[model samples]
Target: MYAHAKEVAEGMLGEANVKIASQNMGGEDFAFYAQKAAGAMFWIGVGNQTTMERVRPLHSPHFVMDESALPIGAAFHASVAIEYLNKNQWCAA
Candidate 1:
């Protein structure tokens, strides 16, 4: 991930909640965007500790989403966008 993008995310999400994942060879479509422009690919954790046993990895046939996390994810996206624009002196309008 771009350093600026990562910094923005950590600032919005809190450093404690931001984890630097080990580099992996997994193929992702976001690579295309990254090659063309500044971009980031981040994961929002949605597993509830109480029901973690029932959680399944993404793309699994039994995968289940924790709907409660929707609002949090939405807010994070908005925060990142607003912060990025502000830092760049660009209006979000």
Candidate 2:
């Protein structure tokens, strides 16, 4: 699952563009969903690399996301869904 997601993401974005972040100690609320089903979460980079500044850390004041990655994220998401459906025959016709 991780490999498929990573490949789809890298294909839509780029090799260097898609990064696997280091593991974090903090847990996400999404963990609840994983208890019921197999799943993986992706984090898209939305930082302002141009400014190289941090207005505030995540879950803090003034945290914002760059909308520039929307198309890339959407493409990756579609690719993942299509690939999974094809592989699993979830909507085979």
Candidate 3:
């Protein structure tokens, strides 16, 4: 899926306008995802600043972030939600 998204993005927009960001996978969350079906998952609450910081170090105890990255995360999540809704034929109930 990531590869396909990258290909489409690059085809539609120049490489300069496309940024590919993939999260580092695997952690305690791996166990959670394994036990459930594809869609069932969990949410962790970390400050957006903290998330941006910790994400970079990959592994560390004292992680922090600036608040400014919130909008990007929100937009990314919104895009994902819309994709899922369309793919699964979901509607508000």
- What tens-digit string does per-residue lDDT give for candidate 1 at 12-87? 7778887887899998898898899777887778877686668888899988888888887888778777776778
RMSD (Cα, Å) for all candidates, in order, is 2.9, 2.5, 7.2
Best model number under TM-score: 1
TM-score, each model? 0.79, 0.78, 0.42
Tell me the RMSD of model 3 versus the true structure.
7.2
lDDT on C-alpha atoms for all candidate structures: 0.77, 0.78, 0.49
Worst 10 residues of 1 by lDDT: 1-10
State, as a TM-score between 0 and 1, how close model 2 is to the true structure: 0.78
- For every model shown, the clashing-pair count is 0, 0, 1
Tens digit of per-residue lDDT, candidate 3, span 29-70: 555755664432322223454345345442556655554656
Whole-model alpha-carbon lDDT for candidate 1: 0.77
lDDT for each residue of candidate 2 in 1-93, tens digit (9 for 90 to 100): 778888887777779888788898887888898789767899766677677566456787788867786777787888999987778775437
Compared with the true structure, model 3 gives a TM-score of: 0.42
Q: Which wins on TM-score, candidate 1 or candidate 2?
A: 1
Return whichever of 1 and 2 wins on lDDT. Answer: 2
